[model samples]
Target: MVTALIVLYFISAITNSKKIVILSGVVFSFLLYPETFFIICAISLLVKILSTYVIIKDLYIALTVLVLILLKNTFFSTASGYQLVGVSFALFQVCYYIKDNISCGDLISKLSFFPQLYCGPIVKPSSFDRLKKINIKSLALYHLIFAIGLFFKIYVAYVTHKIFLEDNSLLNSVFWLAYMYSDYLSWSLMGIGIAGLAGFKMPMSFRAPFFCRNVSQFYSRWNITVFKWCNDFFKVSGSKKYRKYKAYINIIVSVSVLSLWHGLTFNFLSFGIFNITYFLIQNKIKKYRKILLISQILFYFLVGYTFNGIIPNYIFPTISYKYGILFIVSLVTLFLFDFFFYRKVKKIISISPPLVIAVSLIFVTISFFVRHIDGQFYYAQF
Candidate 1:
């Protein structure tokens, strides 16, 4: 699949034809996941038919979410060993196209841009309009970006994952959350790089979320595209008077639906429950920014149990002194990486030709040495 994407990118780059790039990319993705065709096509058609209705906005949003949930229960629940990557992202794009009312000739092509198909920065249709104006450039910088993501996934996250397996201690809990972020950000950066190579600019999924002053701000930066869609689904997609309801109403619905939409498993249920509680508690502590920020980070760390509990054995596992020192080092590395990423320090350094070449060689060498761990990337299963 990666080979095919590289081929598609270079062909488009050589021909200087983005239309062919976007449309043909969709065809390639369909070959990889044909089940997506019916759902995406159905949503596209529905959005086209319903686009003219103005007063039915609330009902329209409700209908779309209900349709997706129904699809989840009927089709997805019954499938065995099926890889349903990109389903939610594709759904989000069509629904956003409906709500935002953007015009695009090939909805599937816009939704399934190959780089972002599995994991996403979830760009809007309006951005596709700018493709023609973007000066085509080599992907040297983007390759370095991809290497950083690969480093996060294979080295940092994989190293940290083994430690917190069944232990749910508060400290290990936070470390597990760090590992999750490392795992998630790995492919997110990779997708962004690949999308850039494909001549599409995907937005960053996070914006210094870990260093924020509070959980509300933390959430304001994290998985922003999904949250925006969820917010509009519950809040902005309604009439003006309906929009005047309490702000938390949208927060509650947005996270709940997002939670279940992610999965029907206990992992997702707890994910939804934890986030809902986390957001609701935000109101009580708004007055204390610094203290609240610290509290929020700790609370988010506790999500280690919610999102990744193997079993309810809340005992703290003993770590050897060496592993303990290594865990602390990993935590510091995670903090510095997030900080550097937000500040674009890494971006500046990655742009050096020598560094890019060095990263490429190291990436190839690591690729040769490591067993294929792509299957273990957290979101690949989704």
Candidate 2:
């Protein structure tokens, strides 16, 4: 009986094109019952359709709904509930983007069952639409690519969890941070590669990001799509009069938004704060290119060592800080090594099909193992 009412409420919300009403219903249901997130997501789809023709106007409304949901969860719900609220808001953002006249074909082309659900490398509607019109032969080739991608997503990310992660500790925390970098790198590569194989041209998350000599370059190489999106939508370009300050502003806003999107956890906020400080410092000394490079390397190292393995859990026992230090250290070390020694990494891989396959396999193995242990889709919680 409760399920039916929830369904009917969503239907009513969408039919009326009233996001506030829909969000209100969702909040009430979640607060009282906590089993309505799924139903809320279903209703969100309907809202997606209803707003298609009036996207510019509705986007703000949708954002408002998300804010309300987050507020309600933060103030009244459990930690799990807060996470769920974050996920719901993330989904709503996607829905709003889709409602902005994104083609069905583009939507299909961008679909990656796992990544699309959780933390995403958020695709632009324009790019998604363009990819949808590819011919069948290309799509067939893409399917083969997608299969390989799926393997990495499942196997590589999953299997490597134990190798890179450990319980909360200073050393373990650093390791986990480093592990997360690699894990995210592998998962993102697989997700984007699969999308590409499906005949969609997607922006990459890491394009030799670790080798970048400075924060600005780091942003360009890491999560390219997210950076581009912020550039476009947030108008993060430096103004002629405020050119010096622009980079700092852009970095702060972009990192903050990215952190929030990860989930409204304290750890996520800390991560963003740390990144923003790093970027700000890096940007100030950018003119001294060599110094900038060295600083970035040191920054990565510190972040890796400090944030990696599972220190957060120990530091704040109420929170899960698995693999905190180790993860951070690994990423920093990898970045430093790649920048200083493996400059030709991209060039070599770009030309080697066999090498690509092997790397893809490794990533798949890690993803599969991680998923098995975590018992949750990494991106699904987005």
Candidate 3:
């Protein structure tokens, strides 16, 4: 099977066989399907040209090309299953590559790298170069990580399926917010796992987000690579050019674009504006930083609730005893586990490889029994 071959490609790096045949097979998997390959190539070419124009400092040409790509992305949606597959990530990579003046060969290689094309932390040009070598000693650890990542994805899928099946209630909403942390965590672990076996010391896509003390900290901790990309865009967009309103403009544009990058929907737009306003207020009240952390926890919960669409009722109209108790227990447990126990848990896992692998296998086994159907990540649609 092609899947097995790809796995072997990573594992075989210990012998440094060059894996030319395996690499070709992996690339061909993307190309074998005519429709998928066509769409990927078309979008890749458009973004490549868009970046080229930007590098030449031809704003008018770049804007024109960008608009055309947007029209293709927005209007002619059928070609890409209406989801536009890798455009969001590929566009980000285009920006990074152009800014760094990467050559055509390198640009194509980076964009077409199959491992991260589906979902990504948006690898930077410098980081992408790590693909050139193999780290044989870490192979066993990488296998453990991949298993853990598999368990995480399966567990999240199972939990979310059950939670959403419940009747519309405030308690379910609270649970959903706490569970949302798993999104980036699962994807990051998978990416890191594959990167490890491939011999690349990839950067983490997330840090301890739930323990974050404020809105600023949350953004920095969650989806770190994308956050940095947006920050880079903001710095160039107007922050450096306009001294007086540097912070104000950067926050406004960055948040808006960040929301837009997620999707072209009212809910996402509102999510962005809500966070922007919250960040501004927190910034204004910097002296009360301690309170902001507590406030941020509540603010993030509301954002998670609003993230999809309007709820059935405005804030738990009349909570049932069962749901209310569940919410309280779940919220308190989440705070304690993520905030207080995280370090200790990491220490335990680090010192005991057998324990780590055993626990991961147990979770993976549990996942097989409770697995349920689910769609791709919300950001995957973008």
Which segments of candidate 2 are over 4 A away from where they belong? 1-99, 102-115, 129-160, 167-174, 236-239, 304-379
lDDT of 1: 0.64
- Rank by TM-score, highest first: 1, 3, 2
Instruction: List the candidates' TM-scores in order.
Output: 0.77, 0.60, 0.72
RMSD of each: 4.5, 10.5, 5.4
Best by lDDT: 1
Candidate 3 error regions (>4 Å): 1-36, 43-54, 57-81, 99-109, 131-137, 165-167, 171-173, 236-245, 314-375
After superposition, candidate 1 runs with Cα above 4 Å error: 1-28, 45-59, 66-83, 99-105, 131-141, 164-172, 236-247, 264-270, 308-314, 318-327, 346-371
- What is the per-residue lDDT of model 2 for residues 1-382, given as tens digits with 9 covering 90 to 100? 1222223223322342223332343344455435434544554565556656454544355445446544544453444554542344334445435556545433322332233323456555544333545443343333334334344334444443554443443334434434455555545544444444433454566666766777667777776766765565555445687787776778776776566555455666677888888887876787998898788767654564422212334443122344334334444545654464236544544565455545544544454445443333343344
How far is 232's C-alpha from truth in model 2 (Å)?
2.7
Best by TM-score: 1
Local accuracy of candidate 3 as per-residue lDDT tens digits, 6-83: 343344333333244225424643664334445555655665676666445434333443444355445434335665
**Residue pairs clashing, model 1:** none
Candidate 3 residue pairs in backbone clash? none
Candidate 3's clash total is 0
